[model samples]
Target: MHIQSCGTAIDVNFKDVGSDRDELLQATKKILQKQLVGQSYRLIILQHILPDTVTFLRMARNAGINVAKVFAKPNSIHKPSLETLVDEGFAVSCLDYGEMEGTEVLDKAILQEHALAVQYQEQLVCVDVGGYFCEPLRRLSPKKLPNFKGVVEVTTFGHNRYSAKVKYLAHPVISLAKSPLKNAEALIVGESATLATDLILRENGYLFVGSKVGVLGFGAIGHSTAKALRSKGHLVTVFDTDPIKRVAAKLEGFGVSSSKQDLLGNCDFVFSATATRAVEVADLKHFQNGLVLVSVGSKANEFDIDGLVDAAETAAIDSDGISCLTYAGGTKLKVLRMGKAVNFHVQSCPDEVMDLVFAETVACMATLSTDLPKSVLSELSDESRKEIAAKWLQRGTYERN
Candidate 1:
């Protein structure tokens, strides 16, 4: 066992199992028993998709914290694989796709500590730059957002969870920059950097050089996605806003699309990373009827494909319903109906996002020193450095709380 500080969060890295988890849990229980003072907290998040069952609930339980109500979104990028805490008698809410569209009052339940379901809105808003549904909440008219706090997601589809409650938030650069990959290769762009990296470097018996690939939106994820495509010797084209970004993309040997429609009839695979209205619903018609588009940004609104891939068409009510899609390319274009649109958001899990989220949450839960243990920050001393490392790690995989 070891203990150290990596800034505001505590990292208790232990090699022991079974007994170790129990011991740590016991230790955590004792700590929380005193900290609670007496009130519970609402731990609202999409967990359980990671390899290790995310232990927020366990941590909360150990802390003697009552989980007000768990937001078990059915349309989550990754639903609980292990037994959800909700399933085990915890107050879990299986959110409907329609409800998840921002149609319901997520905040009402999230903030109220144990409030039961109430009247929901016609639409809910979802922001997943790394999930299957880019436009997760495109169908409803929600009660106007009162302020930014309730509008934005505290945690994105990715594990980059930073709380708005903190005014002077510490930047986690070093943690994000570390190369988690065993053997690092060229970096890939796209919010779902994991899948993009895997697809580019892995020798799965596929051609790369001269392969036509289109990456829509030249944002952070877009640039990364394009770079990965190029690393494998494939020809890549980039389209996005921000002229400077476009210029930078051009410098990288990518063909920048002046307009969303510019992508038509020029590529085989189109990866949309920009959530702007241009590349979203309106751009669906611009594809050459057989274009394959994958989104790792925002909700899956890159295409106006309601009937094409809605829950009704995919029959997501049954098990594994979330991985469904409606192909827009039709028959000839349909021959290439691939798996879940190369969605890393849905494919990644609680384990993947928790390390970052836990670190952030702990940083908020405790402090950089007094509350945070030294063990967690041992990997990097500075929070900014850690974030940089995390950025590097984005292209690969890592494990931890």
Candidate 2:
């Protein structure tokens, strides 16, 4: 199969299970040699890269289609195969934390800024996909905003979660980044840096080596959190109702707990990144004494904040963004960011990481540069995805490895 768009072309050759591995590489090489775009391309492998996959990547690089990046989780790349790819001159920019984008919020310090009303008389307000627009929009309104004429919604994915809350604003709304790719963009850019940065900040300053960490969910955010914690030498245990996710975690060599109680009871630091209500008042009873509860997900209710406030004998925010609380049971806990995303609250995300995500969102917005779409959501052309990738690469946030 072949696909061409955005100044690059992709040619794919599928190999069935038990198919001749040598044959597959040769077939892929022939396709690669036929197409020369004068620029390197990434080989995105969703699953583990077997010997056959490495051979294909190596051959493609020889054909001038250098593997400038490897678009897969770090775990998916077999170490020996990765060694070969690196030895064969592949750049291999793994699209894990390195390609993540959500940390832009911390670099921009959007949280520290007092909510400013939209001052545009008739200008466009583009809420790019960086999860940085919500707090800013809270201060915007027709009455409060100075010279605010209308809003040009550059992205639609934010509507369900953000724009809906600000519907009282009279500005005309124009949703543009509605493409299915936008959702993919969100997945790539939203949680990636947030999880990495949060873990980095906490581990560097607070979480000592070999600390016991419990992750509340096993979804994208939770998975990334667990991976980051594990990388920092923490004994990470994951809690999720989804047996498949639990099994997947176990397969990856991480500890998995079937019950939330098990995770909360055993770990010293518990992070809630489930993107939903994972902990309630009753569950709080299971929390180990002096457990550090940090909410890394953006959404509220992940910790039953109201319940935490009600159950705590004393709750107060510290200068470092930690919420110190004493429960009625006398279990003292330090909740990061008032149970909000810790990175945003502390504004501790590294600047380079934020640049990558901001670059991608800007590139995604540029795809809608032409005539405005009347549709609620639109499709992202292959060109746009390629552009996002290029812009992200151009940002130079993550080095080639």
Candidate 3:
């Protein structure tokens, strides 16, 4: 598909592996260019990343689209870019809560769509990540908003899980899966994740240095978790189904376990870093007593939470705010924030780190609005990496800009 945007034309051949991530980003830009024509479309952005969203809003201005309004968290509305976008006639409003907490904004955005359906018809498009934005929009009664057009759920989570759910919602819901630059952000954000985990462990009175720690999965999160635990003087062991990853971990000066059973059999604390079901009921059977299982991923599907509940003789939160599941065999498993992403659940990530993460997402979104080939997943081109890095390095401090 050939898309022409702002006098620049690019051929989008998703099937062609030769097309790098830059071209894919160009494809996204082209799509947005086409969609935002004649100041007719109302592009409602639930703004998270200030700088990147401003960058996209400028593109919207150049495209002549009506930059209706941007909804951001309450205290996150003071950025210079945000002021620039607002000064340029874009309505920038504040949503209640912090960057990660935008549920109220989702509600208000959907309510705005009701009037927009009657007034604007098909010219309305909402860009949201968490299912919160689209789910309610999808549920809006057709009787009220008969002209409601569609929604685009950007893949904020591991995969495009929300896309399938909204497919049956009777609207053209676009699910853009993992962004190309996700791993790059993952590597950088690992610092905050490590900090959150360390703080949580310490708050619960768990000794870090002397503990036998096992890191499950060898992806970005897994590798970072292992490195962080090792740095804290813990005896860290790595386990993964992939032999190459296990070998890589071994080369990093860490012990490699033959299987999940082996890791479970030896560790005092184990971190589930993979999105998959790395620790199943079968594997839990081999878990050492009084094991601490801190999952640094989402609460859903990362581990077998239901299975853990089923096998446990008692499930309760301890006095120190840690979740504990005691099994019939006198073995107990402790989880952080009930298996949610420890960093996110704790909200321990500093504002600047989240800004960087959100900025990366914005850059990816600028490149994702178009149709991308299903084969290629996450990536960061040299130019794109430099651009993101330049932004990161430019901001020397974590002040609310």
What CA root-mean-square deviation does each model show from the true structure?
Answer: 12.1, 16.4, 12.1
Clashes of each: 66, 2, 2
Best by lDDT: 3
* Steric clash pairs (candidate 2): 101-357, 179-378
TM-score, every prediction: 0.55, 0.49, 0.60
Compared with the true structure, model 3 gives a TM-score of: 0.60
Q: How well does candidate 1 score on lDDT at residue 225?
A: 71
Q: Which 10 successive residues of model 1 have the least lDDT summed? A: 1-10
* C-alpha lDDT score of every prediction, in listed order: 0.39, 0.49, 0.56
Give one digit per residue, the lDDT tens place, for model 2 in 1-401: 01111111111122222223334233233333433333333222222233544655555446553233343332223344445555666544333322233333322322222122222112122332222344444444435433222223333333444455554433333333444333343343334434534554575475446788888777655776777778767898888888998998999988988799989888888887665677888877788998877766433336877787788889886423467789876888777655655533322222233333333333323333333334423333566555544544443222322
> How much is 360 displaced in model 3, in angstroms?
3.5
Better of 1 and 3 by lDDT: 3
For candidate 3, write residues 336-365 as lDDT tens digits.
756655644333333344344444443444
Cα lDDT tens digits, model 1, 248-320, are 9888778887866777557766776654333443444555654555655433345444433442223222111
Ordering by lDDT: 3, 2, 1
Better of 1 and 2 by lDDT: 2
Q: Which residue runs of candidate 2 sit more than 4 Å off their true CA positions?
A: 1-125, 128-207, 241-244, 298-301, 315-321, 345-352, 366-379, 391-401
CA shift of 205, model 1, Å: 12
